[model samples]
Target chain A: GAGVSQSPRYKVAKRGQDVALRCDPISGHVSLFWYQQALGQGPEFLTYFQNEAQLDKSGLPSDRFFAERPEGSVSTLKIQRTQQEDSAVYLCASSLFGQVIYEQYFGPGTRLTVT
Target chain B: QQPVQSPQAVILREGEDAVINCSSSKALYSVHWYRQKHGEAPVFLMILLKGGEQKGHEKISASFNEKKQQSSLYLTASQLSYSGTYFCGTEFQGGSEKLVFGKGTKLTVNP
Candidate 1:
């Protein structure tokens, strides 16, 4: 089977511009996650969703960041009025179930550059 | 919180040993180890559940300390293929499964 996939492998946005990153988790995965990784730093959790219901959004840095997984499958992370600090790799991941396992398949991530 | 990883970077000769430790202030239920090559997604290596269980893959093994909220990765007879950045992701014992990763330790193995 195919692994998780993200679109527009790279994006460059002007300051204050909005951008939307898309993620298609592995088919049938019940748990989806979003992470932001800065250069020279490890990936940081952004948010998470169990099916169509978001289980945790506490990691979202600010109100400009929003994510949705409608239909319990595809997910989109939208950053409104992006700032220079938002320039980082946005990673999406999916696990087979809830917090019962340690394995989570990650995508290549979308490298967003806010100029 | 971000775990603290020691030896921010290390260089090892083939057939040598290296140790990387990750410690957290919060009690953890599990610690996950991963190695990420340059410009790639992190690949999972192993997961250590709370408690002092040691698991080995090839000559690479790790130990977890539940009380201190710390973990260590041990690499033996290091091979050139082992060169990469190692990261420790911690999950609080009882919470939504989110991994709080530490700044990775970069390891370079020379033949």
Candidate 2:
């Protein structure tokens, strides 16, 4: 039983460039979530998906952020025209069945540095 | 809105006890507690549903007061391994499943 995993452990991007971070949820997981954590702060929700349907995106900071879970297993978070403020660690999590009370399994996360 | 966590930071000696509190301004449906070590993803500790159920894990336990929209995590005999940042994520009643998290409470346990 592998846990959730994220790719590109670290990414350095120039301001205004676009970057995409990937996540692989646990097998058979039906709920996936994305969050952003800045230094010295808690993780802030970004978006969520339930079986490929984007259920919640209200937590997204701005229009520049976009995410998708096309296959209901893997997901991607894309940031357009990245700003220095976008520099943070991007985390992905998943639960077995999208249950409100299910404990989410988290990925190692991808640290993005906008220079 | 994000919940507020008390005692932004705390220091404890091994075998001591500590409490971390989280409060929300709105009605809550569920509360989730998580711990994250430096450079690592947050690890789920326990969750309390709207029923105000109390849960325990090892020497760590938590109680949720649904009526007050607050939750408290209690750690007894704190271990060095318990040193990390604790975050409380709250799901408001009538809100989507998205969780709004508190800033976090940093706990440092020394031998």
Candidate 3:
């Protein structure tokens, strides 16, 4: 009955530092997605996974961003050498059947600040 | 590409009505509507599939004009609780797993 959850509700990193955000999807959710939301803007898709496979990563902003869902249940998004431009809210969502028709359940998201 | 949303923002008195529009340049498979309050996750409002489908949620409803590659979200008799940013997510014909969101329309309802 639990919804999606993310860790480190808030994170502050110095420029050039590295950060990792975690996402715990609802039980048995087969599809997971990550998005980035800049201030006053709609969320931008970053990556997506089906089961344990990273099906879509085209939306990732750069090579420095990486994501993994090795077990198909939990996922982690890592950023190497963070910059002020990387500051944003990182959101995670999951769906029951990996279908676009099903509504997604979103997490509270991790707000990352780069200074 | 991100869909375009009109009127970047809107302000209305309680019990008034509002309409938000989303238009895309490419063919779409489905359209999704979401509402997000400040510092919170987006909550799903409804979805409209291709073929000009219409769906309703409480006092809010949406219509998709597949032929025109556009969708409209209608909220009548607005309430304070409806104050938030509204986003329209478009799923293109070939990309079912991803959604491209519009810039969002800020809605403020005053009592």
Score chain B of each candidate by TM-score: 0.97, 0.97, 0.98
Question: Using lDDT as the measure, what is the rank order of every candidate, best first?
Answer: 3, 2, 1
TM-score of chain A of 2: 0.97
Candidate 2: which pairs clash?
none
Off by over 4 Å in 2: none
lDDT of 3 by residue, A1-115 (tens): 9899999999999999999999999999999999999999998999989999999999899999999999899999999999999999999999988777679889999999999
Cα lDDT listed for each candidate: 0.92, 0.94, 0.95
CAPRI accuracy category, model 3: high
Worst 10 contiguous positions by lDDT, candidate 3 chain B: B94-103
Candidate 1 segments whose C-alpha is farther than 4 A from its true place: none
Q: How well is candidate 3 docked (DockQ)?
A: 0.81
B1-111, model 2: which lDDT tens digit per residue?
A: 789999999999999999999999999999999999999989999999888899999999999998888999999999999999999999899857888889999999999
Model 1 lDDT at residue A101: 52
Q: Report per-candidate DockQ.
A: 0.68, 0.81, 0.81
Give the winner by TM-score: 3
lDDT winner between 2 and 3, please give it. Answer: 3
- Arrange candidates by TM-score, highest first: which order? 3, 2, 1
lDDT of 1 at A69: 97
Docking class of 1: medium
